[model samples]
Target: MKRNTNYYIRKAHRYLGLFLGIQFLFWTLGGLYFSWSDIDKIHGEHLVMEKKDFSTTSGLIAPDSILIKINSRQPLTPIAKIELVETLGEPYYQLQLMTGEYRLFSAKTGHLKPQFTKDEVIEIARTYITFEAEVKETELLTIVSNHHEYRERHLPVWAIAFDYEGDPVVYVDAVTGQFERIRHNSWRVFDWLWMMHTMDYETRDNFGNWLLKAFSILGLITVLSGFLLFGVSYNKREFKFLKIKKS
Candidate 1:
C-alpha cells in the first residue's frame, strides 16, 4: 500500500473533519440562537418593571446637605458622581467616590446610610419586579469567579432569587442601593450559547483562545485539502474528448 499526497491529504481532511465537526456545529448552533433571539429578552428586559420617574422630588433635601454630611464622615474623600436616586419609594443620595467606593445617604434627613440591610435589599428587589412572586433565595455576593454572571459588577451585591417562571434573580447594589442586574433562564441559555460561539469555556467571552485557534487552523486545512483532492482526481482526458467531438 503506497501512500501518495492524495491519500495523505484525504486522510488529513477526514480526521480534521472528525475533530472540528463538533466545534463547527456548536458555532452554527450558537449563531442561529443569537440571531433568532431577541437581545432585550436575553438581557431579561421583560422580567423587570418599567423605570419609575423621580421628577416629583420636591420634598427631598438638597444634594449639598448630603455632600456636607459625607465630608464630615469620609473627610477628603473625592467624590466622582452624585445623584438623588430612589430606594423603596424613598429618595437617597448615591455617592460614587473617586476611590471606587459607593455610599448612600438619606435624602430626607441628610444622614449617611450603612450598606443596605438584607431586608432593605429584598424590598428593593421586590419593588423592581412587575409580577407577584415569593422570594426563593437571597445571597450576599461578595466573592465570585470570573465566569460568574455578576462578575465584574459592584461587589457585595444582594442576589434576590424569585419563585418566578424563569427562576429570575435580581441583584441590588448593597452600597448604592440600586438594582444592578436582572438575570433569568433565558439569559443563562444565551450565555451558554455565547460561550460556545466564542469557544471560551472559562471566561465565556474570549474569542481568541489556543483551542479555538487550533481548531480553526485544522478546519481551514480540511477545506484546502478537499479542494486539492478534487484537483488531483480531475481527469483532463474527458474535457479533451468533449472538445475533440465538438470540433
Candidate 2:
C-alpha cells in the first residue's frame, strides 16, 4: 500500500510538471528578455527628437477674443477639454468637445484651421524623427483592436513608418498634431512576450485574468504536493531501515 501510494504520487508529479512546464518556460523567457532588453531602445527613444517647448508664451492672441469667436462660430458646443498645443512649432489652441470632436485654432491669429492632412503630417514627421531616414509608409489610423500597439491613445493618428533599422514607426496625433509613440521590431517582441507573461491575450494589460488565476492556484498545489512527496519518501526510508534491523 505504501509503495502503491508512492507510485501514484510520482505519476501525479510527472503529469503536473508536464502541464506547467510550457507556461513556466514562457515566464522565465519573458523575465530574461525584459531584464536584458534596453527599455529605451524598445520604446524607440533614439528615433525621436525632443519636443520643443510650447513656443514663446508672449505675443499670442488674446484667449478671450478667441473664445468669443469660437462661441459665435459654433455656439452651444460643450467643450470637454482645451489646451495650448503646437503643430509644426507654431502655437495653437486645441479644443476637444464632449461629443468627441477635435478642433485646432491658431494661437496667434485665433483662426480655426482644418484637421491634419497626410501631406501636412509629412513635414511634421520630417522634423520629428532624429535620424536621416526616408518615410516608408504614411497611414491614417482611426480604429484599433484590443491588442493593438497604439491602444488607449487618442484615435485618428498618422502612422509614419520609417526605413530605419528595427523598422520603426512613429505615431502622431492627427487631431492634436503631436507626437504620440514609436513602435519597432524590438517593441513587437517585447509586446508578444508581455502578452505571454500577463496571459491576457485579449487586452494584454489585464493582470487578473481567469487563465492566469487558474494556473497560479495549480502552481501552488503542485508546490505543496512536492513537499508531501518529500515527506513520504523520507518515511519510507525509515520504515525500510527498521524492517532490515528486525530481519
> Who wins the lDDT comparison?
2
Candidate 2 lDDT score relative to the true structure: 0.86
- Per-residue lDDT tens digits of candidate 2, residues 167-240? 88888888878778989999999999999999999989899999999988888877887887888899778999
What TM-scores do the predictions have?
0.89, 0.89
- Please report the TM-score between candidate 1 and the true structure: 0.89
Q: For all candidates, what are the clash counts?
A: 0, 0
- lDDT of the candidates, in the order given: 0.85, 0.86
- Which segments of candidate 1 are over 4 A away from where they belong? 1-3, 236-247
Error of 2 at 181 (Å): 0.7
In model 2, state the lDDT of residue 210: 97
